[model samples]
Target: MLFKEVIGQESIKENLIQTVVNERISHAQMFQGKLGSGSFSLALAYAQFVFCSNKEENDSCGACPSCLKINTLTHPDLHFSFPVQILGNLKKSDDFISEFREMMISNPYSTEQDWYGKNENENKKGIIGVDESKELFRKLSLKSYEGGYKVAIIWLAENMNIASANKLLKLIEEPPEKTLLFLVVEDLEKILATIISRTQIIRLKSLSEVQISNQLANHHGVDEAKAIEISTYVNGDFAMALHEVSSQDNSQVFFDLFVSWMRLCFKKDVVGAVAFSANIQKLGKEKQKAFLLFVLNLFQKSLLGNFSGMENVKITPSHKEFIEKFMPYVHERNMEALHTDMSQAYYHIDRNANAKILFLDLSFILFKLIKK
Candidate 1:
């Protein structure tokens, strides 16, 4: 991806380009940002610029041989290490490298959940282990085939275990000549302090609502008003905005169910709430979890609307209708309780709690809170 292809973050792109032009590139760098904020895309773009034979002042020349290779992720000098689950005989990152390349080429804006869904069939954890770190060290020990820079990009670096993190500390501290490591992490606090100290951290901000809406209109042929609606719901997450706009299945259904649930809560209809919870439990675990998060966001937006008035709020037509009906129940006295209940539900879901029981419990609590 070229610098211009990435949305917004013009100043950050300029800074990265200037670093390469001045020959002051750091051996190890960390791209820390929220998911879907273009951190990984920026890292890829910077790597392309660094290796481009005909790079311009602002971005890489898209027509160059090196650019073509990087675009397909087949460059000999560029290597990637990401979290992967052990499946069948596929024991390492190398085993899944072909699939990884195809997935990225198909969609570079995917998240860890998307990767896990595409690569693994059953529910399996993805983590970076010691064996992968050993492989990374061995690869970096070799001389670059293209005789330029050898880049090792570790996506979701925070998922690295303690053993793997400790093993790579030495290499991160003192890499071989012309070697660069790009660590992409969603949450910086999860990374070990030792590793964080060794790398230069680059903070990436979320795209503005206008930027996301404009990109949605241009890239996906979405209408401006619909794009703006999705952008507001996504809250600066472009990947999610794209998913919501493009997908016709689960997310759309969840939005409808969420609107209905809020309306039920507002009316204090215990029978409807119980029926809604049962329907939510039938949507599968992933969808159930997604619905819970969606409900939490809806509550937040309602509370924000309650305090700031309706003019400042942005929501879809369905959501706005539900919020208008539900606004009277979400006063300051009950907002904290509502948030806490949603937080507890999320915690239970993360711990693999029974979705049926959890949703029933959450619905009952909302039923009580809304009555007050």
Candidate 2:
């Protein structure tokens, strides 16, 4: 991907371009950012630009042979290492390289969860193993086949196991001439300090709401109003905005359930809350997780609306209708208490706590808080 094609982050693009122009490119660099921030895309763009035979002033020439191969992620000199799961038949990320290429070509803004879903391995965990780290050394030890810089893009480098991370430390410290390593990391804290000290860290900022809305409108044919709505809810996450648009409309159901739960909480209706929890427990795990996240987002938006004075808060049509009627009940008096309760609920859900007991307990606490 050419740097020009990446949306927003004009300053970051300029900085990266200048690095190449000045010949000050670091041997190993870490592109650190939250999910959906385009860290991987930026790394790919930089790699393409670095290896492009016909490089332009600010970006790679897309028509060049190198650019073409990089665009398809088939560049002989460009290698990738990422997390993989050991399923029944699929043992490694390389085993599913075809799917990986297709997914990246289709949407580079995808999250780890999206990748897992595409591979139908959402229930399993993925990690970079010692074998993968050894393979990295093997690949880097050899000279470039195409007579250009060898680029290794390690996506989600923080997922590397202890052995892999330690093995990679020496490589990061000193690699062969004309070798570049781009480590895309979501959580910098998870990476070993030794590795961090060896690589130049480039922190990526999330796209602004305006940038997201504009891109959605131009690229996806979404109208300005709807694009803006999605942008607000997405909170600078392009992948999530795309998912929100692509997924089925379950906002009404979520809103109804949220309203009912809130009412049960306010009334101290323990029996009613228990029944409600039992009903929610019957939903699939993904649905349950989605519902919980939706509720969390809704609470955050409500708090922002009440205090942050950010008028651009976007809720679904049903949610807007409900919130308008419900806003008076969610003022400063109970906002903090509500946030605490919601956070506790999220913690419980994340730990695989019994959904029924978790929700019931949360409802009881909310009942006390709502009336406080």
Candidate 3:
């Protein structure tokens, strides 16, 4: 995505643009930000500007061969290393290049969750293992095919294990000539201190609510009032805000399913709960995740509705009725446990865990919590 296409972060964009203009680019830099903050987009745009055959003062010339290649994320000199699960014996990042390319082309603001959904692996932990790191080292060792800078983007770099980080440390210490490394991470503290020291850090702040709202209104075709409400609910997570807008149709379905699941669990209806789990198992990994997220989001709203107010809660009439009745159950005693259970379920689902067992197990936990 071009700098212009990415919403907000104008100052960050200008700083990135000026890096190339001044010709003082760092060989290794970390673009650290929260999920949906557009760190990847910034890195991609920066790489595009660096490799642009006809570079403009503010952005890359989109018509150039280099620009076109980078836009599609197929640039010969551009390589990506991201978290991936072991499919059979294959754990290589290169194995999922086509999907990765398509995903970014469609949504540059995608998170690790999005990547997990794309691969449809059940709760399989995506990591940058030592094997993948060695592969990256091999790829970066080669000279740039186009006779320019080679860009290596390590998406979710914090997912790298110790061995992988060590291997990457070697490369960063003595990187190939004309090579630039972009280590994109969500959590800074998780990364090895040595690795952090080796790279220049560029922070991408989360988008403001207004920025996210405008993006939803203009691009997602959301009405202003709805976009503003969604933005507030999302609390500046553009990826989630966009997701909520795009998946608006599923809102009611998720709501009804959640209510049913809670009722089954609360009533100790094992047969009903098992059947519910079976149905959830059939919804595929992404929808399963969306269901969990929907449930968690509602719990958050209900908690607020119980204590503070529903000023920020965005939902339909059915959800409103449910929350109005359910608010008392979502107390301080159970809110944390409820959120933790659902969040952990979401995480496990991304890792390709068994959905039936997971959902049923979560049902038991919810039953105990709801009893409180």
Candidate 4:
């Protein structure tokens, strides 16, 4: 992944290049970013640039032997460690090297859910187990194969268990000569403080709306209307944009659910809302969070529909028709309240709050807000 190929993050690319030029490359660094924010891609590109024999000022020369190997993730010196499932006495990432490479090739934007889809078994959770730490130490202990930097890119490093994190502390603090550690993290808060203290942190933030829109249109071949609409709803999350494109009907699914729930609330039918809540609770926590985001995005669209200023809003023609009807119910008085309540619901859902009750309470709130 060359810097030119990775979309957006121009400033970050320049900063990373400067690090190489100044010979200030840190031994241990964490590339922390939200899922789908191009952190992984940037880190890989940076590593390739660091290893490239014919390095240009802006990017690595892709034709170089080092660039060729790193591009395929087959470089003897470029290593990766990510979350892996414990497969019947198999605890180390080495056991699933082929699957890992396949995943890296097929879907670099994947989160834990995608990782689970690839390698998890029996709904088992993926984690960086303590046993893998020993394996990590062993791999890093070896001399660089090509007499270049031994770079270890630890994807999803936040999943490391406490014991594993502790074992990595000493190594990160003082790595072997010319060794580089790239810890890619999604959930920054979950990482251990001790581990964080040992490494230089490179923060990656979300992309802009235009950047995301172009990404969708260019990468997924998504139509202009949908690319615009999805870019609006995804809040700069590239993975969510891809998911929205793949599951365009997901919008309609949420639309149907939203229309039904709001109708129940409009009639002030607590009984109906409670039953709806019960049904929503059956969708599980992850789906519940997705639904909340869908609703929040819909709220923005609906609010814009209240007036003739449709240029600022992005929605399908079919969705615009419903928004035309629903617009009167959403106003400044209620949209803020709705956003706050819905965002709060999403937060609580992450912490394992009772879904049924939470939805029930929100239903009543929506009932009153709709009438306001």
Candidate 5:
């Protein structure tokens, strides 16, 4: 991925480029951003720029052997460490490298949910185990194949287990000479403080609506009007915009579930809410979190609509009427608590809590808070 290929973040691209041009690159750096913000793509571009022998003024020379190798994710000096579902003998990231590469090639903006959903293991839990960290250590300890900087890009670094995180933290402390470690992460809180202290943080902001709209129309062949509409509704999340343009059914299903769940909460219908929770438990863990995030985003939009007007908010058209009715319920009195409880539910779901019980409890909490 070249810096120019990333949708937005021109300033960050320049900063990364300057690091290479000035030969002042940090040994350990963390690329933190929201899901779909192109942090992964940026990290890859930065690596390519560092390894490019025929570097351009603002980007890597794509024709160079080093650039071509990294572009295909086959560069010996470029290593990727990511979360992997332990399936029998396939316990390490390398065991699933082919699938990961395919995913990146298909959609560099894919979210964690997209990854697990496409995994061959039916979206099982993925984690960076101790073994993966050990493997990474051994690989980095070797001499650089290109006699240049050895780049280790750890995607979803927060997925590393405590043991793995500790083992990797040691490497960060005493990193090999001419090594660049890029820890690309979505959630900073999940990362260890020890590791966090050791790495330079490179934060990527969400893309603007205009940026997303242009990408959709210019690259994805989406019609201008539809692209603009999708971009507005996605709240600067490029992945969500792509999903909308692709006409995926996940958002529709999530919309229906949110409406039903909200109605149940409004009426304090414990029986109905319990049934809804039971049904939601059937979704994969990642999907469950995605659903909660959707709900939270809706809540945020509704709150904005409440303060201003519906015209000022960019909710899905099919959801507008429902949100208009729901807006009054989510006000200053309860919006914070609503966000808190929903966020907690998402956190618990990610941690492998009993989904049925967790969602059931969350429904009860929402029943109280939404009434405020």
Candidate 6:
């Protein structure tokens, strides 16, 4: 992956290039960003840039042997450690190397949910176990195969167990000569403080709507208007934008659910809302969180439309009519309350709260807040 291939983050790319050019590369660094923000892609590109023999000023020379190997994730010096389902004897990420490479090749912006899909198992959680840390140490202990930097890119580093984190901390604290560690994290809070203290943190912001829209149109061949709509709807999440394009039915389901839930809230139908909450609980925690995020994004857009005027609102034709009708209710008076409660609901759902009861309480709150 070259810097040119990663969408947006132009400033970050320049800064990373400067680090390499000035020989100020940190031995241990953390690339922190939300999912679908292209942090992983950026980190991979950075590593490739470091390894490239014929490096260009702005990006890596893709035709170079090092670039080719790194692009295919087959470089001896470039190592990867990621969360893995410890199924039977398959305990380490190396055990799932082929699948991991395939996933990255297919979609560099893949989420943990996409990782789960590759295994066809969503129920079992993935983790960076202590054994993975042991493997990391062993790999890094070896001399760089190409007599260059040995780079280890750990994806979803927050999933590391306490033991794994501690082991990694030692490596960070006293890293081997010519070794680089890139910890790619989605949740910075989940990482151990000791580990964080040792590494330079590179924060990545979300991609712009235009960036995502251009990628959708140019690379994915999505129609211009629909691509822009999805880019706006996903709120800078490129992975979600891709999902929205490929899974229109899923978006329709979320739309129908949102419409029904809003109706229940607007009418103050507690009984109906509670029943609806029960059904939503059946979608499982991940889907439940996705739904709540969808609703939150819509509410935000609606509030924007209300305050900024409808001309500023970029919504799909399917949702435009309903949102225009709903915009007035999500004004300054209730917008804060709505955002707070919905965000809290999403947070709790992610932490495995009782979804049915939580959704019920949220529904009742929305009933009062929506029309305030």
lDDT of each candidate versus the true structure:
0.81, 0.81, 0.85, 0.83, 0.87, 0.89
* Model 6 poorest 10 in a row by lDDT: 228-237
Model 5 deviation from native, Cα RMSD in Å: 5.5
Instruction: State which candidate, 1 or 5, has the greater lDDT.
Output: 5
Score candidate 2 by lDDT: 0.81
Per-residue accuracy of model 2 over 1-372 as CA lDDT, tens digit each: 999778777888898899888999998999999657788899999999988888889999999999899989999888898888866665555777788889999988878888888878787779888878888888888999998689999989999999999988978877877889999999999999999989999988888889888888899887676676666545577877788678635555666898998878777888899899999898655456657766766776776676654356665554676665556566778778777777677667767888898888877777776542
How many steric clashes does model 3 contain? Answer: 9
lDDT of 2 at 195: 95
| Candidate that beats the other on TM-score, 5 or 6, i.e. the better one | 6
Backbone N/Cα/C clashes per model: 0, 1, 9, 0, 0, 0
User: What is the clash count of model 4?
Assistant: 0
Can you give the lDDT of residue 138 in candidate 2?
85
| Predicted structure 4, TM vs. truth | 0.89
Q: In lDDT terms, which candidate is top? A: 6
> For model 5, how does the per-residue alpha-carbon lDDT over 186-263 read when each residue is reduced to its tens digit?
999999999999999999888987999899989999877557656654656788788877875677788899999999
Q: Once model 1 is optimally superposed onto the true structure by TM-score, how far is the C-alpha of residue 66 displaced, in angstroms?
A: 1.0
| Per-residue alpha-carbon lDDT of candidate 4 for residues 1-372, written as tens digits (9 for 90 to 100) | 889877788888999999999999988888888768878888899999999999998999999999888767899998888778887888888788788887776656766677787654537778888888888888889998999789888889988998988877877877878889889998889998888888788888788879888988887798887887767656667877777888787667777998899889899898998899999999888678878887888788778767556667778777777777787888888888899999999999989999999999999998789964
TM-score of each: 0.76, 0.77, 0.70, 0.89, 0.72, 0.82
Using TM-score as the yardstick, the better of models 1 and 5 is 1
Range of the 10 consecutive residues with the lowest summed lDDT in candidate 5: 225-234
User: Which wins on lDDT, candidate 1 or candidate 6?
Assistant: 6
Better of 5 and 6 by lDDT: 6
Error of 5 at 256 (Å): 8.7
lDDT of 3 by residue, 194-301 (tens): 999989999887788789988888887888766765665454578878788777756667767988987887798889988999999998887787678768877888
Q: What is the lDDT of residue 366 in candidate 3?
A: 77
Q: Which stretches of candidate 1 lie over 4 Å from their true place?
A: 249-255, 270-372
Residue 342 local lDDT, model 3: 83
